[model samples]
Target chain A: MLSIQNLHVQVEEKEILKGINLEVKPGELHVIMGRNGTGKSTLANVLAGRDKYTVPQGNITFNNESLLDKTPEDRACSGLFLSFQYPVAIPGVNNMYFLKAAVNAIRKSRGQDEMDAIDFLAMVREKLKEVALDESFIHRPVNDGFSGGEKKRNEILQMITLEPQLSILDETDSGLDIDALKIVAQGVNDYRSPERSFILITHYQRILNYMQPDFVHVLMNGKLVKSGTMELANELEEKGYSWIEKELTAAD
Target chain B: MENEIIKKSIAEEYKYGFETKVAQDTFPPGLDEGVIRALSDIKGEPEWLLEWRLKAYHHWLNMKEPTWAKVHYPPIDYQSISYYSAPKKKTLNSLDEVDPEILDTYNKLGIPLDEQKMLAGVAVDAVFDSVSVATTFKDTLKKAGVIFCSFSEAVKDHPELVQKYLGSVVPYTDNFYATLNSAVFSDGSFVYIPKGVRCPMELSTYFRINAANTGQFERTLIVADEGSHVSYLEGCTAPMRDENQLHAAVVELVALGNAEIKYSTVQNWYPGDKEGKGGIYNFVTKRGACRGDKSKISWTQVETGSAITWKYPSCILQGNDSVGEFYSVALTNNFQQADTGTKMIHLGKNTKSTIISKGISAGKGQQTYRGEVKIMKSAENSRNFSQCDSILIGDECGAHTFPYIDVRNSTAQMEHEATTSNIGEDQLFYCNQRGISTEDAVSLIVNGFCKEVFKELPMEFAVEAQKLMEVSLEGAVG
Candidate 1:
């Protein structure tokens, strides 16, 4: 469903991602683990069509179409979702209203009619249950005054509500507690289907204990150095990323 | 690329810019005692009113236009602006006798003059240029002991009420522009709710400036008697002109014991072109007086147009336990500049006031929120709470706040909060990633920022205000 070929990205005239290549098929889950400043979040943002990052080399394709010229909204309407590392706090916009706008905008782009308020509310309530958020959240401003765990759970709630074809979860589990992490993973697991895929970008391996992944890759210096199964995640958890850096140095 | 889009959006044309073609009785461009006398004579005013106009005219000659506001414009050529311009229709006993061109103009502005086609609960008084052309639901209002008519009609038919309440809140000698407005003010609306009677419907006045090179000076006075209630609304718009047209209006409101008066305004005058060539110079004075114990007054305004807007609708809480409230949403785009807020003067014991102001600046627009809350020594145990917030859309725009607070009574409690923020790229990207367009995102964020003030508006006006915000911030994303 998604392909990235030797993608090179830069921000503020400094290269952040150099010659990174990745591929994911339908229904597959890919976990990219890296330390700080290793371009894990950069790859997720570049895929979501954030304009601040410039792509100077190679290409990225989604559903067999080049995504370089598509706007962020266009990319979103084409079934791409990015769970931001830090959710923005829109002070007075109700979460329900914002979600309805998003849902209707995507539905309109797909040549479908808008979802009525009644039906949308019903769907949102059900999705809230999956993320363990109560009805009070719908009335509050979008992410304003939300705790770290609540924000992560809200991202997962959005992922469930949008039902995107490919979702990039950028550090969604970084600040979550054990209970919140399980709830977020449960929401993701319940929403997974044969035609949906996810790229979970995180700095910890704790969340992997709740949800299984098809592939685990270690990202270092903007490149995917190693790719393996869940056992590699367990190995990295037992020994931190420093061992991987030592291995890369010995290989060089 | 983003800057180009922002420029394109801010360049959106003013929608209410079409002129009305009508034969007008316009005075030649000049301002003097003779012109004021001629204006009063043309209106067939009583001798006392004419003398009052002369008094205000003499006072205006001594007063200089104040320039402390954070706005820049060339000096106004007061001598070059015609003081009076009205459609040449002499007398109108009914809507049938009104000029079709004037009626067509109002109809095109979405205000149907015919009673049956108007909004269900809104009684409208349509003022064209310098005269009140038509007033609807007069008989219905009269049956409820409510006197709703033009200022001139009130002067002729209900002179006692007019003389009692006119200038009671904001006198003719209030300020420079107000003094000028009093001298040659042509026509506006007057509403009076009798003692213990609640107004049955919404009272609204629509002011339209159609004539070229003419200044529009209208006076509006509303009085809510003891135990009465009323909701009044004012709307204004002007045709596009090459030279800046002047609009100086004065509105005074009075609420007696247990009376509640709600005043709302949606000001959408022509805000000039992209380069700010021509538009309305709106300098208005609006004030309300709580004259008896337990009286309440609220001022809600949504201002989105005019090349330069200088207004501060104020309230004087003179009655013990009286309440005053001000809610405003001012949006400035293109080259528009607005310096507006409200003032609350607490003069009675246990009086309270609340102010919520929201300002949005886009393009090269500049906006300021200047508010004042004063608690006098006599206002023992008074309280005031104020919140002022501003949001800037583009890099070139500016937002400023100047809040003046003076509390002489130690028992008084005052709270003030202010914030300034930009529509950051991250917020826009977050909305875009959710499948919403940048334009829609801008509207959403701005409407959210203005939610507090918009909630204070009437339902219909609230919806119109939201749509106006969307139009004003059309492509303001950066």
Candidate 2:
């Protein structure tokens, strides 16, 4: 459903993503693991069409259409969702109102009728349960004064509510506690279907322990150096990423 | 890329900028004792009222225009402006007798002068350039013992009430603009609710300026007698022009013992173009007084248009246990400037006041919130709460706040809070990624910022205020 081929990205004259490539079909979950400052988040941001990160050379296709020319809002209306690492705090816009606006905006672009207010509220409340957030969370301002874990959970709540075709979670599990991590993983797992796809950008394999992925890739210094199955994550968890760097050095 | 969207949106023209075609009787473009006397004569005013106008005119000649507001403009030549312009067809006994062209103007403005087709529960007084052409539901108001008519008609019908309440709240010598308004005021609505009576319908006035090079000076007075209650609303708009037009108005309200008066305004005069070439110089003075025990007065305004707006709708809490409230949302876009707020004076024991003001600036617009809260020694246990918040959309815009407080009584309590915030790029990106356009995102953020003050408006007005805000902030996001 999505393809990125020979993608080279830069920000402010500094290359962040060296010629890298990946592909995923429908219903597939792919995990990108990397250390800090290793172009992991850059790949996610570029995929979501952030203007700060420029694509120097390469093409990204969603549903066989070029995504480079689409605006971030248009990309989102076309069913691409990115759960931010640090969710922004919009002071006076409540979570329920923001979600309804987002949902109706996308629905209108898709030529669908606006969701009824009562039905929308019911759907949102049900999604709140999967994220382990109480009813009061929907009434509060979006992400304002939320604890680190609650903010992460709020991101998950939005992900499930939007119900995008391709979802990208950028370190959503970083600040989450163990219990919150399980809840987030369960929410993602429940949202997984044959028609949807997922790209999880994270540093650790703890979240992967609860949810299975079809493919695992390791990125280092603006390039993906390794690709394997779930067992690679288990091995990396044991010996760390230095083992792969040593292997690459030996081959060089 | 988003900057391109902002520029494109800002290019949209003002919606209500069309002029009407009609024959008009306009005065010569100058102001003197002869002009004032001629204006008073044309209106057929009584001797005493004419003397009052002469007195105000003499006082205005000696007073200079105040330059302390946070605004800049070319010096105004008062003599270059015509004092009066009215439709040639005068003296309408009913809506049917009104000129069809004028009716068509009101229809295009979405205000039907015909009572049957008008918005239910609203009695409108459609005021053209220099006259109140028609006031709907007058018979019904009269049956309820409510006096709702043009100021000229009130001067001829209920002279005692007009004489007793005129200049009681805001005297003619109060300020520069107010004195000028009093000297040559044309026509506006006058309302009076009787003792222990509640007005059945909402009273409203729609002011429009059509004649070129002519100033619009309207005076509004409302009085609620003992134990009476009334709610009044005013709306204004002007046709776009290449030269600035002066609009100086005076509004005074008085509430007696146990009476309550709620006044709301939606001022949408024609703001100048993006280059700041032409628009309305809206200098207005509005104030209310709680004159007797347990009386209340509230002012709520949504000011979204004008090249330069300098106004302060204040309240004097005079009677013991009286209350006053002010809620305002003023927005400036595309080179517009506004300096507006309210003043609350406490002179009675246990009096209370609340002030909530919101300012939004975008597209090189500038705004200021200047308010004062004063407590006199006679006010033994008075209290006041004030909050002012401003949101700036672009880097070129500005927002300023100046709050003054004085307390002569140690027992009086005052609370003040202020905040200024910018619409950041991060916030815009967040909303854009959520599938909302940049324009809609800006509107959402701004509406959220002004939600506190918007709730104070009437139900119908709140919706219109939101839509007006959306239109005014179209190009604000950068």
What are the per-model numbers of colliding residue pairs?
Answer: 0, 0
Clashes of 2: 0
Summarize candidate 1's per-residue lDDT along B1-478 as a digit string, tens digits. 4566676664777789999888999999999999999999998999989988999999999999989988899999999999999898874578988899988988888885789896667999988989998999888998998998889999999999988877778788889999999899999999989999999999999999999999999999999999999999888889988899999999999999999999999999999998899999999999999989999999999999899999999999999999999999999988999999999999999999999999999999999999999999999999999999999887789999999999999999999999999888888889999999998999999999999999998899999899988887776664
lDDT of 2: 0.91
TM-scores of chain A, one for each prediction:
0.98, 0.98
Choose the strongest candidate by lDDT. Answer: 1
Error of 1 at B426 (Å): 0.8
Models 1 onward score TM values of 0.99, 0.97
Q: Is the docking of candidate 2 incorrect, acceptable, medium or high quality?
A: medium
- In Å, what is the interface RMSD of model 1? 1.1
Clash pairs (backbone) in predicted model 1 = none
Q: What are the candidates' interface root-mean-square deviations?
A: 1.1, 1.2
DockQ top scorer = 1
C-alpha RMSD between model 2 and the true structure: 1.8
lDDT of 1 at A72: 92
